[model samples]
Target: MRRYGIQPVASITDDLDIAPLLITSVGRLLWRYRSELAPVTMLALLIGTGTILHSSYRLWWPTVAGITALVAGVLLYAGRWVNLTRPIERAYAATATAFAGGWLTTSTAHGPFTKPLPLVLAIGCVVLAAPWWAHRRRRARVRVERTLAAWPDIAQAAGLAGSRVQSAIVDLWGYRFRLGLGLGQTVEDAVAAVPRLESALGSTRGGVRVQPVASKKANRADVRVIETDPHANAITWPGPSITFITQPAKLGLFEDGAPVRVPLLRRHGLFGGVSGAGKSGGVNVLLGELTACPDVILWGIDLKRGMELQPWASCIDRLATTPQEAEALLRDAVIVLDGRADDLAQRGKRVWDPSPARPALVIIIDEYAELASEAPQAIDHADSIARRGRAVAVQLVAATQRPSKDAMGKSAVRSQMDIRVCFRVREARDADLILGQGMVKTGWHAHKLDAPGKFLISSPDHDIPRRARTYLLDDHGVHTTTERHSTHRPSLDAVSVQALERAAEMPITEDAPPPSREAEKVLMAALRQAPAEGVRINDLMRATRMRRTWVYQRLQDLARTQQAEQVSRGFWRATPEKHAQ
Candidate 1:
């Protein structure tokens, strides 16, 4: 009998222990699903409130109705203050408020247990709960909350143990969070673990981007998880984003839907990529923006026989299509650079202030490698412009396949580029050549860029490796934009014109005969050797070591006698008969 009595007492103690455990488990489940059970909790609260009001303030139905109207009106009119950004969300909130207040008022006026009142409350709860359960932003916010709540485990899996989510926000494309890292952990450590973090967070490859926080705290990182690509499609050109070269040009949209603006004034830019990586399209877009600015004069060098830049010929102040032409164009650009420097020195100014009356000059060189190889003599002039052009508002924008030292004429031109835009490349090492040395190890990864028009930009303003896409300006867009902007194009400023005139009038030597005769001989020889496609007039000028007027005069004399013929619009070549003669 003593043993059995002891067993019963022990059983009573065990039962007491299990009772609290069971209650705790139940409470944990309720809290875990609180958002899903919100409608049920709200219905119960309404019932209790209605019962109390009916017992104490049964005559307050009118006051309740008035309050409901005021609340609904506020929600409908100024719902954004409460984080309701969409009109549909605001309307839903107002309707729900009016419905709940109407049901409560009726319950207060009549008995809380009235026949239709209880049925009406049940129907209203189901109707309102449906929309609340299906809202996208609300669901996203819930997911973010749960993800952050489990961030410690995620961090551990991603090799960032002890890192905690400090704050988070959901946006249209995806969500981002502020991460507080463990001791000795830096933003580089977080960036290096992006692939692991993406796996731990179940995001797609390249979806996780870890950047240093704006405050530049050592232990903080801004982690962005991209659920949708904002630059997936070819963004159409949006006319122009600037009226002057002083402002930054809007190149395209970043992955996070922010504008990729870089100051082009007084800056030399280098754009590099593979042949089909949309580098040409990027150049066209750049020209479209620059052409619209009245304070900019555009020059282009397309050694592919003007196939790429011919569409914008109306807007371009000068376009070069051959090796000799490229040389002459760069040489003239140096002349303009010198002229502007002189003007600035006269006025004691540090930089050239561009205006419609005195516009900036932008020389865009396509296939810079071709220029380096074909016009080796021009590289010295290009190097000079690259070094001294910035202070005088004369800038060079060189586009090439790869900016190797040899490809860039083994000169300082590549080193002088302040803005580097790298599109997709065939090899990983090519990214380093285009962007900088060791950029691949630093996570630029331009080789992995999946599509055309996609690029990675590096400038003084952009230090991180964020992928962006350039706007696409199709053939029709090119035509329309050029036609519209051609009429408004600004001419060469007086300073630049006077400099060229002075250069032309300068004497070659005191004893040398007139240069026109010898220059004509060199020009004719170049034309005879020119390919079937013919040579550009700029090339003739460069070969003859003369000005544009001198080259045109000789060309007209040859054409009138049928010794040379105009093969195309801006191209000339000695006639086959003249070559035989």
Candidate 2:
């Protein structure tokens, strides 16, 4: 038994010869824990450098100190480039570098392990290692490495057998990996296998996401796994993000905390979401911004008896509560539109440039479906404005519970919207209805939004399907913002005011009333000078500074008195007897 197994060693060697193997194993173990052993390695390197410098080039210690000072200075401002993202991280890096460099410089001039120097090095190493070992991002990176090491098997089980991870980034909310798909494989395949991949990676349902790399290619995908959700809580609205109508309206925030800003200038917007999905909250945020702009004049149609837009009534120039009033408001807006258009044409300008004197007009319609059902006529004018208003700085911002074709019927008003914000919807098809056709298939799954303010936007500049949330301006906040900005609000310019006055002075129908002495005189003069054939109602109205109804009433009186006569349908002329006068 004593002679058995070749004394537990190779046949040509004794057991003592196994020392080399043991040493090699220990070296590999140390290398495996290199990050944890960093402080010790640094200390040894400092000692070695000091020993060599003291023996050969101790005079270079001052130069070492100067070089260390310069490096620390560079790291102060440029540390972000090296992944020292936070100020504290930069401070720690600079401090560590300075301490190590200073110790080496002092040790080089004296002895390698003099007096309190060794003790200081030991204490400093422990202190620095504490932060390094407990860093959240560092731990995330290590976990990512371990997870990636098992990715080959995970990929095989998840139906992506040959794909390989090209790169990865660990962020605050989650980690993402850039994948290189196998030949003949596609991003669709990866997307289809998302559930399987989530299970294989030990992530929750809906935790795994796959997006195609924005290229003309289908073989690359970016897989994101959410370990934490950044948008789980309500983001408090930071006051007015912009003070002018020309700036983008800062809405809420994206998942990465970037502001969701969509320009409101000269753009018609639609916000659609179910009840309690924060559609009103979204409108409140918009009102907060529009009220702050002196170059913007706001009008609102709150068909819910002004329940929704009442708090900001102070800032709104006109608020329509009933369907009749809504229709009249839109009609007046058309008059303003015509005036602005004619003005621009005369000046040879293609667009209405907004300013304090020539402010832009923004009409906010809450529960637009009610407007469609109650004031159907208003929809026609709204459609006209939507089609032609962008150039003249007259735009609509309508919010509705559902934007179904029936709810937004006849006008195709939904089609003209330039910016769309969609909140939580009831069905997969509803997302398409609110955003556009096939939006759910394209990854704008508004039905999946978990919170009230969460939404998805589709705009000219943002064509991709990224989820967002609208800023929540509560009742108190709304009142405060409106009151603060009320004094700075701009009035309607002269052109717009005259256009509205011309409309207001007009009678509703020819049968309503008789004109005053001066009004009657103006009408009689217009009829007496009418063209031989006839003068159109519009022409007579414009010539007499009256409305269509007013012109008709005066013409009717003139005809009855033999001072005017109808030459044809919708045409009028002065009679021979009247010409004699």
Candidate 3:
């Protein structure tokens, strides 16, 4: 029985030995064909070496130390490549060279116990490929720079100055300098090279007049050129151009630099122009510039189905599209103004006191005619906001295709909107309505603006009207600006919509019949039991828990219904018809 047990034990030991040998053979075969198997085989070899050293020496310190160093070194080298550091690649190459040399020396010294040479070869191969990868990246960068350098000149020749230009390559950063004529050019050359010089001049109804500022003494080249209010400051080009200024030069400022820094919101401008005269586009430019100011809170109203102003919905705090919405917005603004005025009166503070904390509110309206036509009540509210809103730092900028006195009634609203912009009106009378009387004499005729987005700006303080360029907002600019300031959008939810619907559907309580009609039948029965007069308005209100106005109106309505009569201002008595059968 002992001999039988020993035989079985020996057989198990042989099977265990043969199993490892089979595993090693299969692992070596896999490592020969698959590159991924190199790391796996190295790990297995590390484990086998550790086991052998632990059992033979009864100590695993050397094996553990060697394995740890190998692991840490491999990870460090791999991390360098992952980080894309060129210097680290050089370090890896150096380490690989030293390792190959050390391995060759060790293998020659200890022949049969030599480690795997294939893994060393793989590391060396990866290190050798790094220079080619770095060279390809450098070439790609140079090609992008060359392509971007050519676009600005092409855009200028195409008459696209002062516009944002997009390039196919995103990494190109130095495209701004190549937009216009290069250095050492004369004034004539610069003007001639500028795209659409004639069109730009003719669109403004002004002749191009360039003057040389100074010339370089040694090179005899014109160093500077100035165009006299030639209407190129805010002109829209076919493509994009980088902007250096936040606000475009006002007509007065461009003419003689009078009112050097006019407060845009304080001016309380009104925009009036004919349809397709770029009135909405002008508002877009104004709002675009204003949004960059962190202090300003923009509000917008568009009664033309909201298409013109929806692009800027993200930047504006309030956006109202329908007449009811406009009325609500105006009423809310009026309430805010009144509240602010009351607070200021209490605090002994005045508006326009140059306080950053009390920033102005700018309400911009698009298609004012439609708003007036839909909600006639909004006219008085808007007028009130215009008249008294300025005291509380509330301002209005209303735009309309028709500037007739009938459209925007000739009242305090029109007179109070001091700053006005007129673009391509159908008649000289329309321009007169927008730019005061006889503005056509001062070159403020809308017939002159044949261009789509051109307009003439006129103010009470300016001596003469000047044509100001308008920018056409493309999709990309709108998307980018809106995305950047998306937090300003009004917070609307399903609950708010449902609440609005409920309010709209709710019956007017003043128009509703009194519950006393039903109560009167009971009261009449009680009266039949014991005759008495009708109930007081106060008692009715207290009994029904209705508002005082509602109860009073209901009592007046009851008098009309022949159910009650008011004997005095505060007294009521049941009528004979009401008491009779």
Candidate 4:
């Protein structure tokens, strides 16, 4: 083999010691050719020397031939033979042959073959090394593959065990995991599987927890297995395909195989779930179904910049984005509720018993927590509404990410809310709080929810819990439904408005006023002297000149400001704050 120009071979053998020698030899050859360029420059020097010598000696042919060969070789190297390839090599060879032929055809004293020979050979050396470089790259890849293939079977066997345990591989954005049961599992056995897998796979420090899925069906005997990893973040459903059952009095969907249905306008309803647990989508499904009924007026509150409830704004009678707006809305709602209550009371009815003529008002809140946080006034107003709003054909559907006592409040508002919708939470305590204490024993842990939008709905009527499928509400569905219902706007009954206004104005202080100023001064002096425990609306009317309506309105304003608390329907309490003020 011509060591300076021949290609090197890549070895397939494990102990290919000759491969390095071949590479070294090839590198030396390439270096030798690179040095040959200097010889070409030396030849050019000789050509110049010869040309000068010929010029001085009057050797015209010799000088012309040397200059011509130098020019040709420079042009060939610069323009055609820069990169060594077959075409460049052929061209270089042809050019060298032409230079040699020209030198041969010329006089003996003028031949310039020596000048171009080194340049052509140098190009040839580089062209020969191309194949050796390619061969080395191929051999390296093959070695890697072979090394990987030669690994012990134990490495592959570890993954194989997990494959049998995987029930399903759920791909939630930002996370993915194999969800199923591990072998040798119990109710507690499934719980044990996670720690082992976490240890095997090296636990991530992202507060990720492994939880067991509870079986709901008692009668059916099937091998129940629930496997979840923190990596299995959100369970995404295919589309807005919710499985729900509708009845004359109630309509509901199943959450985690638990049935949650509410009676139509039966004390209204409340929903609380953490963000990304499909709270918005769940509400969308509820509203979508409710809007289909012609008798319901949809009112909504979205304190999260209005994006959540804006879609349904056109279909709804009123929508509020700020606490101030919500205050006005609740104020208006109270008015409406009072009017309806009075109308029902006049008809000897306690509640708005559903009839074909009497349509119900459904108020939906997307983020009740935000509303409560921003407007504490609205919270009390909401409490009052929830307490009395249902009797006048008004209902509420509120959803929140945090359903803690502070967010929804435990005392007044939460007690009035009858229905609960629990989604995936970070704690079992949350599931207990939302779904009731029985949920934890049933393994209805919200923290273990594998799917993003999945939830567990619990209501007073549900005998056995049923899993409810959440429906995805796209823009088109929202827009079309809103447009279709644009013509039908729910009008607040005039009677309800008047009764609410009347209720709001109920007398707060017996000494505050009567029908006129003269009688008011008499009651005021009496109150100033005695400072009775609280004021009665009836007593204020009897003692003061102010009319019943005027005295009532002033009392309501006082009660609203907490100057006095409404003790009973027509009675008021003078708080210490009121006395101090």
Candidate 5:
């Protein structure tokens, strides 16, 4: 009897040890596949809830149905509040809720164990769970969660141990996280570890980006993992983004699929990249947007005999194809700038408010390096426009293969460009020439951009470095767009036109003042005797024995006082009554 008892007790003790091991194994599996098992767990919960309600509150099925309907309706109509932004996600949520509630309501009335009810619940759960398990975004979210959960190990493998993920978000392209660094760690440290991080996370080369947080926190960095490349192809132009110059122009798209809208109303922009880097494509996209604006008069200087800008000549108010023409265009732009500044001063306004009758001037210079070297005299005027053009809505958009000090000229033009776009540069230091000093070290890695049209923009709206791609406007696109927008193009404002006319009439000598005696009398007499076509500004300068500046200023004053008027650009005439006087 003792031998038999000892054998049975030993077998029971072995079984007890195996039971604990089995429970531990199951718990590990449930934790390992928590995201994947969510739907199964939810179904189990629903079954238990239905059974409990059927036992105690069978009569409350109608209330449960009504509440379920209300909740499903909210989920269908307003699921964005719950972070369900996609239409399919909202629909799935609503359908899942309806299925769960309908099962609960029926089970509460008929009992959860009733013959086909259990079978029906199982079928419905499978049907709904299929979509939940197959959802791409959901899978991505789960993957991001698991990766973040393992970030400590990943960071350690990448020589960045103790770095913690503060917050994370998953989007269509990829995921981004705010990382809190350990003591003595910096964003540069994280940037330098990008390759290691990509390897640690099993990502492809150049798949991870480390940027400094917008808050400028010393110990924080924004890390982006590019699971899907958004700028893999050239984005086609979607036509003009704005009809007025005041609104921001949609230049391209960011990696997160957001529009790269930068306001060009009163800002100078610089575009720098190597040849064949799609700098021209970016310029074309910008012109497509700016040309559509009725309150912007477009002027272009393409020193390569208009090779780059000739396609949009129908829309550009002035297209300079020669070095002489380029120099003249920039000189006239400065004259217009001075004229608008004076007008704003007289009106007691701090800025020029552009309108159809008073349009803003946007000068686009393609191959700016050529202009700098070929027409060096124009750099001073370009510098002046860059310095003071913003207030009066005179903007300069300069595009160059390389914006070196020698290529951009020794001027403030590069420094004053508030919106800087660096495309696929040949060297890292070239980014600093285009984007500003110390930009390369700060993670503005324009040199790493591999594809044409891929760029990094730095502006008041976009201070952080994010990869973006410019819209493609091929030759056909440029032709169609220019033809569509040419009819809507506004002529230069009277102030700018008159200023250009005076500049055209100026003598070779610079800043020469008018004769002190009989200048006003001679100008009035010339206007009275002027042909019906009206007197040219050159003729007026000759008649008054005055400088072009003096003649233009007096004419503007007389026209304002209703004593004189412009017959055409650079042409003026006196009123009939004033001539009689």
Candidate 6:
């Protein structure tokens, strides 16, 4: 034998061990291709069993078939016990098991080499094996096996030499493995070596992510290998998902296609993003659901001259267009809040429970930075509400382009936000501004969001950084929702109305100005110029220079005399004769 790079063997004993060497070489070859030999090995085992049964126990074929059916049934329904998560994969496994068992039963009744039995076995094996070979999970499993086989070398090269893969799960998006660090190693070391690990494991540049396992020991990590993109398209809205004001509103779908249900009942939320980053669309979805609730009273402050909130003005109880109106509206809300608190105290209740008679107040503020700049005083009231309103079911949902300390009027507004959504931002630090400080460094990479609707939510229920996309509610949707729900919109409860009356120092009237000659002429002018959609209570208050109680009282008297009409809830306009008069 020719040995190119070795010294010549001169000893006869060293060269004479051919038999043992041949056996050892064959053993190594079999070990190397063991997975590929699995099917053939199983086939051989089946053939041996068939021969034994046919030769000595052919009468047991019926029992074999019964056992086969039972096994197939167990495998089909309880396949999760064996790690089959997908229904299709479980079905396939059951089918294969049935085919093999039935073929073995028939073969046992005849012989392993029986002509038709052999043919059926051959055809069935190939047919069943086709799916096994083509299955994604099976392929992924094989890949995982190969990777684990080379893990020692990979770990050594990636500066994680002492770590070992404990277990792995192949998912729809990718695969995740639980890794056990060495005695002195920590999960931080593994996280720090993520880039090198990805390279060593032959994954894409940004494919690997290492998360510490939630355990007291700092020696375990969950290493995920992302092989697929989850946020490839915009998930369409599935309509209003909430009926009552107490349930969480369905925002959109997360990367895993699960619904993103966010609780809006008593929580304050802040939506921050760049211009045209689907912030308005997300808020519209919230409005669509909130409008459908009968136990919620909707209020809005749109400082962009009501451009964003006007579409749903018919449903909103109060809509603020400019700075002065916004200030007045917030002040009134605070009055209502204080009133509810006193009522709760008098009733021996710790918190106000909302019902149709006592609806929760949700204020949707669009472009909150404008409110901060134009009506800085309103921010104080907002801060008060944020700090104390949750228990009483008074919530604020603010959307802003920039929610910095200065942009938010250098108040506790940002800090008071319990639920925050950070959309696509220009800088990494901007994520910290929206989601709170140090969020960017902790892997809340909102700046990496590629799409407009994509965002990361930080709330009590959702603390983990999972990418989610908001359902887009366009202008048509807004108009449709407002029209459908405007009639059912709940008016502010008596407690809030009474509070407003005390603030105005007059008895509130739903229908006649509390005898104000100066306010009557201004109310008439506003009624004449009111748009087809009519004007909201705040607009009428602005026009009439009167409190909402006086406006309602005067409007009631005008409607009674056929001089004015209510176009929608909380919206009134003058009749043709009244306008001319």
Global Cα lDDT for candidate 5: 0.87
**Cα RMSDs of all predictions?**
7.3, 11.1, 24.5, 22.1, 7.8, 4.6
Query: Against the hidden reference, what TM-scores do the models get?
Result: 0.81, 0.81, 0.44, 0.46, 0.84, 0.85
lDDT of 4 by residue, 141-227 (tens): 343333333323312332323223222221211121223433433333333334343334333422223333334322211112122
Give all candidates' CA lDDT scores. 0.87, 0.83, 0.55, 0.55, 0.87, 0.83
Ranking by lDDT: 1, 5, 2, 6, 4, 3
TM-score of 3: 0.44
Candidate 5 residue lDDT tens string, 102-179: 999999998999989989988988998899899888899888888888988998999899899999998888989999
Using TM-score as the measure, the top candidate is: 6
Q: Give me the runs in candidate 4 sitting further than 4 Å from their true place.
A: 1-262, 355-357, 500-581
Q: Tell me the TM-score of model 4.
A: 0.46
Q: Backbone clashes in each candidate structure, one number apiece?
A: 0, 0, 5, 34, 0, 4
| Residues 50-126 of candidate 3: C-alpha lDDT, one tens digit per residue | 34554555344544446545654664566455443456544654554444434433333333144564465456545
lDDT of 1 by residue, 1-581 (tens): 66667543444554477878899999988987788888999899999999999999999999999999999999999999988978999999999999999988999999678989999999999999999999888888888788778888898999999888988988777899999999889888897898999998989998888877768688998898989887778899888888889999999888877889999998999999999999988898899899889999998999999999989987887788889778878888888899988998999999989999999999999999999999999999989999999988899999999898899996599999999999999999999998989888767889888899999999999988888999999999999998888878886787887777677567754533455666777888899999999997767766776666346656766887999997755678899987998
Q: How does residue 345 of candidate 6 score in lDDT?
A: 92
- Candidate 5, run of 10 with poorest lDDT: 6-15
Error (Å) of candidate 1 at residue 91 is 3.5
